[model samples]
Target chain A: MSLSVAMPDRRVRATAAVVVAAVLVVLSVVFACAVGAVHIPPGDVIDGLLDRSDPVTRQIVWQIRFPRALVAALVGANLGIAGVLLQGITRNPLGDPHILGFSAGAGVAAVGLLRVAPEVPLALVPAAAFGGALASAALVYALAWRGGISPVRFALAGVAVAALFTALSTALIATSKLFTQAALAFLAGGLYQRGWEHVHQVWPYTLVGGLIALIVADSLNVLALGDDVARGLGMRVERTRALLAALAAVLTGAAVAVVGLVAFVGLVVPHIARLLVGSDQRVVLPLSALLGALLLVLSDSIARVVVAPGEIPVGIITAIVGAPVLLILIRTRT
Target chain B: MRSSARRTTAILGTAVAAFALLLTACGTDETAVPTATASAQGTATAAATQAAPVGVTVTDLMGRKVTVAKTPTKIVTTSPSALEMLYAAGGTAIARSSTAAAPGIDTSKMTDIGSAYQPNFEAILKLQPDLVVADASAQAPLAGQFEAQLKGVPVVFVGAVKYADVATSIRMLGLVTGTAEKAKTSADAIDATAKQVGDAVKGKTATKTLVVVAGRDGQLSAALNDSFIGDMVKIAGAQNIAAELKQSGQVPGYATISLETAFKDNPDVLLVIVPGNTPGPSISSIVARTFPNLNAVKNKRVHEISLDIFLQAPGPRAADGLKELTTFIQPDVKLGAAVVPGY
Candidate 1:
């Protein structure tokens, strides 16, 4: 194994990767803001930012493009860290927030609420989704526990729970005729037409989740060493795993709450981060967040322009790009 | 072994061909024709002329040629837009699919035949409609199911995706309903309205417009070329920012554009078309609060229009839709205000 080899240079590599990723995230935000269905010259984009003299340009920058791009970066950061936490806790490379069925649980509860109460105030629907995700996470945790949770058992339970929750959500959609179009689109996972109200909704959870992940960063590093080793090292492995998973659920729930479900970001971003820097959770976590933010912001920007005035699903763009990046990583690693 | 496998393949091919033939032979044209005797609530308006049936060989929007024994007495529209077109053509139906409750049409006596996209074949058949019409442009994949359900009933599809298609489809509906004269009157009225819009903006400079449909899902998508609203925007003498984009999948001439691109295009006129019963702050608020620099918002030109006029059977009141678009895009051009149809 290259673990011993990778260990020595990891600190330096991680620091370098972090700087590179941070730079990329900032650049992605700028790129997204400057380009859209409407074209503003790069100078005007910069001028719109610093000068604010051109009313139209200023509005496009500050009001529309800026908020959208900012929200995208924020969402990326949320999903990115969530991916790191979930993957670390489960010791499953394929693991992400959905490993706890957060998305499906959020979907079921959101659909049920939408069907039962046609008017659950648009601003507050994310709360309903967050509630659903927590509930599903609880369910997955309860079922996966047999004295203590193993990664395989927990993942299988999560998959099953996700399936059940997804089915229940679809059943609600199928049976309810009064569900609004927004209600359905909310479940499809895109930031299309999302604005500041959405930004307001996701901000608290992102702050809380990101901070929690940072505080628990050392715990995650200990937990990544198998449970026996972690326990021997005086770490409360089960409790730490639970806390990390819960934090991931919160982050995933928050992301899903705002954009419904953006595919591949949470699943792909962490591994890509680890591949860029070594497998040190401390380094990988922030790197994942930056990479996730950069990837989504850039993908969203492309989603806006690829068809010009028309936009395709952002998930499609991410998957198209994400799958290839992941495949290359797998082949090169193999 | 290979010969035996070949023999099985030949047998299976024969069976498939036989099945196809059987499906084709399941019903004859005579059985598909609805009886002219009993007319439904809306169809009775045509009863005065239905007593003497006339046969017309007409090609539908999908290019399927259909022969009608007489004007259909019982009619069902699967989509809201088609129902609107049917009403505008001065025809009525005995039943409609679930989402067909548009303004002005009375659905109290109409049976709900499921949804326009997945209409209940049994319910549609129970009505014994002489003719069934659906929006082919919206649900072309469902066409075969309707055709397969035909015991003798002729199912016609209309592509009411544009202002022109609305008038053409209305004229076709007139042909199917023995209301050709009535259809002509309504079509001419719509055409006259178009002429009015054209005349008002005859020599005016067109505005570069962006029409984004605010979906019920809180999504904003660009209304592209050939779309109902896209076409209306063009006829009103405005340049569509999403112009030249081809129709895609189920959405036809619309594509989801990011808010950045939408704002970047900086349309002179921006129209947000909300395609649902409930209106939310997702779009209006975003445009007002988030894009203050947009020419539309800065000049107070970001207009929010309901789905009824935009999505209701394309072209039903398109002349009116065009008129409104013209006034917004070319304010100096004076076009008379038109009624907001039944909705």
Candidate 2:
């Protein structure tokens, strides 16, 4: 837990970097709003936000696209923060939200809810998702906890559990004829007709998860050093790690609930941020948020216009971009 | 490590910021949707009638716009619907047809291109058709590739989803092939047959009917509401069970529903369409094994019809299929007189 010798200079530079990232996030949001299959001018996009003339344009901009863009940013930020926390606690560069079986757990629960209780409101999807995610995370943590949560053991257990749950989910979907198409679409992870309802549904979990990640930022910075070192430095390492795991679960669950499974953002963005702003959680966490938001928004925008009147899934674009970044990170780590 | 982290973050931030700026500049001058696009018009009409022997341009169902210098001299039709329309419009077909299972086309002089599920693309190219007409599903995936390869040749893809779309396709083919007068005459005859069937079944009580196209494995598949057979069912005044269970984005293909569910629904009439001589249990035997107590099978309301008439190809013979369906659904409706060959 020795402080880097250039602490003051590092702090100053991190602060400036964060300010720049914040500006980029704002610009990303505006950029997302301006472009879609139906082109609304930037002036009209701004005016639509301000509730000026042209009610149709205003409704399309604010009601349909704006909320979706906001949700993308929020989902991205949540995932980015969760990735940093998980990787820091596990001390594994390959640590991701999906590897922990959170998304599979959420998908299973969502499919079950749709099949058994079709009358349930769309808003309940995330709640069911979060519940399933927490239950699965707890199960994995318990099974992997022999003495301490070994990164390798935890990853192995998580992957195994994830595969099992995913198979169960697929079986359930295939069996029920009524939920087949919806289940397939959900599994594919496209944002075709998403609106304000999805945005309002997942925001609470995202906010809470993000806030908790920020509060435990310092503990994570210590935990990244190693469990014994963190504990010797007066940090409750096990408790801190557990809290971060719960926080990550909430973020991952909420995102999966809203958008099904968006792969690679969680793993790739955090590593990219860590490479840029150092391994310090304080800098890496916020930088991951900005970078994740920016990347997803750009990817979504490209997906929107790549085929006129047709859209490729955002997940496809993210994976195509994120996979190379992941390979580079693994090579660097080795 | 921190400085490296800062530099990576900086590169990502700059890249995103640059894209955002580019989007903002581009967004202002976005192209407007053209107001006068021909597709906007509901009726398929040219702005002005050109003189006789006008060069024809047709946008096929696969969204490929084909321009023919004149009416095609050598045509190869892979779709029975397209062939029926072409023959009914008096086109001189040079070579090739779909299958013996397909109704309406005179397959006596035509070479078979395998089955409807799989078309032999090489055989088709070897036919050297100046114009090729195929179903949309068969042509959609290969539309771009075919367009590139067959640059000089024209391929028209027809989607025979609705009965109205069939008529429209016939008209489009007529316009393109310089057989407008003959197309109109054939279209009128088909429309007349449909009207006669409609008049015959007008006062009959609506019967719940399940029309299934039997697959290779002897499993019954429900034809979609948007499919040609589904349209026939509706026109014949029969309530289709499969149509009732449909949801959006779900392609109406054969789904394996349990015998219990089928019996519980208890359709009054069951029409099974099976293709040429694939040995299996007859529809009656299959029904008896699956649902012995169902009213349709118990009362001998189940009937086996040729796969040709109902499910495989759609054209003038679709009217005949409707007539046959109406007769089966309502036994009192007599389709009297002679059985027409290519009606």
Query: How would you encode candidate 1's per-residue C-alpha lDDT over B71-95 as one tens digit per residue?
Result: 7788888777677777777788887
For each candidate, give the interface RMSD after superposing the true interface residues on Cα. 26.5, 14.5
What TM-score would you give candidate 1 relative to the actual structure? 0.53
* Model 2 spans with C-alpha error above 4 angstroms: A1-3, A116-123, A177-179, A325-334, B1-255, B258-343
DockQ versus reference, model 1 = 0.01
Candidate 1 deviant stretches above 4 angstroms: A1-8, A51-53, A177-180, B1-343
What C-alpha lDDT, on a 0 to 100 scale, does residue A62 get in candidate 2? 62
Q: Which candidate comes out best when scored by TM-score?
A: 2
lDDT of 2 by residue, A1-334 (tens): 3556667676667767767877887777778777765677788889876667364565556655666676787778778887888788678886788776777787788777766655466557667877888888888788789877776677777788889889988777655542144566566676654655566666666555665666567687787777788878998766777788888888888787778878888889988877665777867877787778767777777776665335667889888877787678668874
Docking quality class, candidate 2: incorrect
lDDT of 2 by residue, B1-343 (tens): 5686456445544553453344333333221111122134312323322334366888876666766666788887766666776676667565444453344445677755444333443345545677877767534544554543333467787756666566667767787788887777766666666677778889888888887755554544666566677787777778888776543212333444545565567888887777657686776677877787787878888988757556566665665667778788877887654233342
- Angstrom error of the Cα, residue A317, model 2: value is 1.8
**Tens digits of per-residue lDDT for model 1 on A1-334?**
6665555476567667776776787677678878875677777887765544464565456445665676687788788898888888788887877645778898888877776665455556788888898888888888989999887788888889988988887777654422245556666666665555566666666655665676567677778788999999999888887888788888888888888867789899998888877676766777787788888888888877775444566778888888899889978983
